[model samples]
Target: MNEQTVTRDERAGEEAADPNRLLPDEDPSSHDPDDARHWLEVYDELLDFKRKMLTIAEEALDGMRDKPARREVVDTDRRVLRAECDRFEKRLAFWRNRLAAARDGKGP
Candidate 1:
C-alpha cells in the first residue's frame, strides 16, 4: 500500500468508528522495481526544482540593491521553494525508508 491507501484506510476507519482498521498496511518494499524507480525519479525532479528556485532566490537577493521589486518576487519564489522543499523532503524520506527496508529484507 502507498500513502494514499493508508490515508484512505484511516479515513474509512474513522467514519466507521473501527479502531482495528485505523492503521493501514503499507508494505512499501514490496512495490515493483519500476515503481521504486519512478518514485526516485520524482524525488530527483523535486530536488532539481528546489535547487533552481534557490538559484533564482540568490540572484534576486544579489540584485536587491538595484531592484526592490525583484527582491519581492525573489522572496515570494523562495517561500514557494521552501514549501516545495518541505513537501519533497517528506516524500524523499519516505522513499529512503522504503529503500532501507528493502535492503534489510523488510517491507517498508
Candidate 2:
C-alpha cells in the first residue's frame, strides 16, 4: 500500500483502540449540549490543574539550583513535567476543537 493508505489504516487502528476517538463524519446532533458543557468544564479544570502542577515543578527545579548533587533527579523531574504539560496541551486542544465542532454542528 502507499504511504497515505498505510497511514489511514494506522489511524483507523488507533481510533479503534481509543474508544473516545471522535470521527469527523460523526453526527454532532446526537450529542447532548449539557454533556458537552460539563465536559468542557471538566477539561478546563484539568487544564488548570496541569498549569498548577507545571508551576510546582518549576518551583521544585528552582529549589534544586543550589544543590548540584541532585541535578540528575531534578532533570528527570523536569522531563516528566514537560511530558505531562505536553499531554495536557494536546488534551486541551482536543477539547477546544471538540467544542468548536459541536458549535459548528460538525463532528469533532
TM per candidate = 0.58, 0.53
Candidate 2 is scored at a TM of 0.53
Candidate 1, 1-108: lDDT as tens digits: 999999998885354333222113333445454555567677779678787877877776775776867766666557656666665666667777666666677753
**lDDT tens digits by residue: candidate 2, 1-108:** 899999998886455345354435433344555555655566567658767876886777766766864586466555555555565456556656667777788863
lDDT of 2 at 24: 51
Q: Model 2: runs farther than 4 Å from truth? A: 1-32, 66-69
Per-residue lDDT of 39 in model 1: 74
lDDT of the structure predicted as candidate 2: 0.60
Q: How accurate is candidate 1 locally (lDDT)?
A: 0.62
Lowest-scoring 10 consecutive residues by lDDT in candidate 2?
Answer: 19-28
* Error in Å for residue 96 of model 1: 1.0
- What does each candidate score in C-alpha RMSD? 11.5, 10.2
Clashing pairs in 1: none
Backbone collision count in every prediction?
A: 0, 0
Worst 10 residues of 1 by lDDT: 17-26
